[model samples]
Target chain A: MSSKKIKAQMRVFQELENQLLIQADKLGVKDDYNPIKIKEMEYDALKNHLLSFYSERSNIEYEMQVLGTDKKEVLIKLEKLEIYIKRAERLLDMYKKYFGKVFKTQNEEKEKIEKFLTKSRISVSVGEN
Target chain B: MAYEAPTIAANLSQDKMFSAQKAAYQKLKEEVPKEKQNEGTQQMSSLVWETVEGKDGSKTYKVGMQDTVYLAAASSALAEDEVESLSKNNNLRFRDKTLQVLKNKMVKLAMDTFSHNFFVAELSKMGVGVITFQMGLLGISPAEIEKLMSKAREEKNIAVKNGLAQVASEKALFGIVTGAKIV
Candidate 1:
């Protein structure tokens, strides 16, 4: 490719990358009283943010290869992003597991109490009749 | 006239000479191991002497330590009187060649410094760009982002100032190396 064309393409890629980052900055979790719900929202936002980063990184890598430039700088940024993404993922997983267990236990307890109440009401109706 | 050895050396006692030599040897012993570890690397060693040929076909021995404290004793021994006499002498080709080598080294060093600072400044700017992208992913506050961006700008400004100073020095050194007459 001609140098001028490559330069122009690089400029477009940079602008697109900037837009993606701005979109990510604008991402916010909805206000919720439930901590689990808040975390879930955060996880979704983070997942989308990570997707943007991955796409942007791939685009940069492809362009760098085409332009015959060194990939060291891009690789460094990717490495740092990877570390943060992994930590975020770990936290998300922990919250999911903890909340999932709590909800399961609560549902089981609720079901047992409802069954006992139903049996008691049937016995009371029969006595009244 | 030949460059006469400075008479200051004659005043030094045997004990002082021995002590100086001992100290130099001790320093060499300490530093040689560090240099050995850097062996096979691209780093230049000050202990190594280089020979530069003059335009007049005279050879001069120069070492990187000429600007360092390792040569303090030798530089002190050169004495201002001997240096002035050498400069005034008709057959001072060696002294002129040495001066030329020093000037060349200074110009080269200034150029290197300028390029290094410029590169670092560019890298700092790039780092800020990357961090701006990361702030969104990491959910950093606007206030924090403002602080970080300002700090990055400050760092880049300092590096640019340093680079400009080096460029000015490089120009002056280049003029000296080329024997340009200063007004």
Candidate 2:
């Protein structure tokens, strides 16, 4: 086929990529109050989309390479999609990496503070006696 | 040039945040394989936020040792913007430079074709000379013009290809890290 036809196909992919990127960016925001269950569910869905896009783009590039077609245009579009997917995935990874640990620490600290308060109350009662 | 790196002050509160993150990362280090613990540590270190002290007895917090995934995500968004802008600017510059080089090459080729035609016609002053020189200039015959066009095509392909490859890698293209379990 002609470069023009390839470019037209690439433009369609680019639009899809941009839409996915915007969606990814929106979902990537980590809300402190968002329940872990909900966050995980949303994250899983976002990741599935990203993975699919990445896979599709890779397949296209591979096919182009195997067929010995002029791949520069397709590669450029694929690369952009890759970037969006990566950024989205990186955000998701950050959420996975620290979210559990952070909340765990917060809970641990809260328990410790509660324990200290209870012990201080008992001590005060004994002193009054 | 207008962009300054984010900074955080080395105050006690900021120190606590950094230390908390450090401790958290250290805890995470236990989960990684013994051989890969160092690599894990390096990766975790990138998450730390740096603190800087201001002259006015104040502090600024930068993207380092973040306390929560929220903070990291927020910072990552900012970093993404910065990186995107920088890459776009760089790509435009590189493209313009390449175009300029291509432009010069085309101009030189035109001048060479003109000179060759002019000189041959002036020297020979015959139908054969005129026909050969004109054919060479018009790229009609399989001759010197064909060689020049072939070289031009090769150079154009090399220079034009892989501009966006710098933005993303072939490795990254194939290896997308999805969370465990499709659900």
Candidate 3:
């Protein structure tokens, strides 16, 4: 691909990143309760968005390889996408643990509920028997 | 007379051997047909032809490379064509996969932002209702508690509506930027 095209594509990704950052900032300011947490969540969401693109690009690369038709331009594009994705991931990680504690808490709560429901079901089954 | 040692090996033999090798190389070059010679020259103007001796004492002409980048460029062009054809054949697959991933991400974003906000709003309403009830029980005027509850409810409702609007706007922004529908 031409350098101009690559630059244009990079600008698009940058624009997306800017939009996400602006939204995150807005969420932080608006959140009277846990502004930092909300902002971090927004950042994480954006990172995941980029990650999805990274994954899709990877799939494209694999597909291209399988077809025995690797394109230098496509590979370059994927590499560029990876760089942005990594940067986003790093930035989010630097601020917080990057989707660890939040997911852990949610999972823990879910597990607890599941265990409680299982116990209740077992007890009810025993009573019926 | 000064080389009294009588040079152990006469240089004549070495020269004769070199002459023979040169003759053999010339002969081999001649054996290569005129058409083949012209074809090699046409393909690579700066081609360096060399005679290589095998273990069996057979000589063969080998072409050597001078500085050239055309071959690399040609191979790259060929590779590009192959990739273009493959991409064209599987264009639909690629499009489907891209759209599928995009849709999935959109759905996840909706769940993460919109549903979570809605859930929080609902929980806030419930919490406010409980607080008002408790305040009423604690000898606060029932009418005052009711009024506070109504105000809190209204605020929560507006917040929920705002959250929904924000999510809708976000979706619209994504659609505008990417030129793709959220679905």
C-alpha TM-scores of all predictions: 0.28, 0.26, 0.25
- Using DockQ as the yardstick, the better of models 1 and 3 is 3
Question: Candidate 2 chain A: worst 10 consecutive residues by lDDT?
Answer: A24-33
Model 2 stretches with alpha carbons more than 4 Å out: A1-34, A117-129, B1-183
Candidate 3 lDDT over B60-166, as tens digits, reads 22323311222222222233433334334433332232232323322222222312234543443333333332232223344554344344334434554455345
**Which tens-of-lDDT digit does each residue in B58-140 have in candidate 2?**
22233222133334223322344333343344333322322333333342342232121345322322322222232322223
lDDT of each: 0.42, 0.41, 0.42
Candidates 1 and 2 compared: the better one by lDDT is: 1
Stretches > 4 Å off in candidate 3: A1-32, A97-129, B1-183
Residue A71 error for model 3, in Å?
Answer: 2.5
Error in Å for residue B8 of model 1? 99
- Count clashing pairs, candidate 2: 11
- Candidate 3 lDDT over residue span A22-129, tens digit each: 333323322442434444445545555666767877787787888865688777877766765665555556445635766788899999999999888843345654
Ten residues in sequence with the least summed lDDT for candidate 3 chain B: B1-10
lDDT string, candidate 2, A87-126, tens digits: 6677567657667787899899999999999888843345
* lDDT per residue (tens digit) for residues A1-129 in model 1: 455655565465445433323222222111221345433444455455557657777776776688866668877876765665565455446556777897999899999999999878844345654
Give Cα distance to truth, residue A121, candidate 3, Å.
Answer: 48
Task: Give the TM-score comparing model 2 with the true structure, all chains together.
Answer: 0.26
Report the C-alpha displacement of residue B40, candidate 2, in angstroms. 95
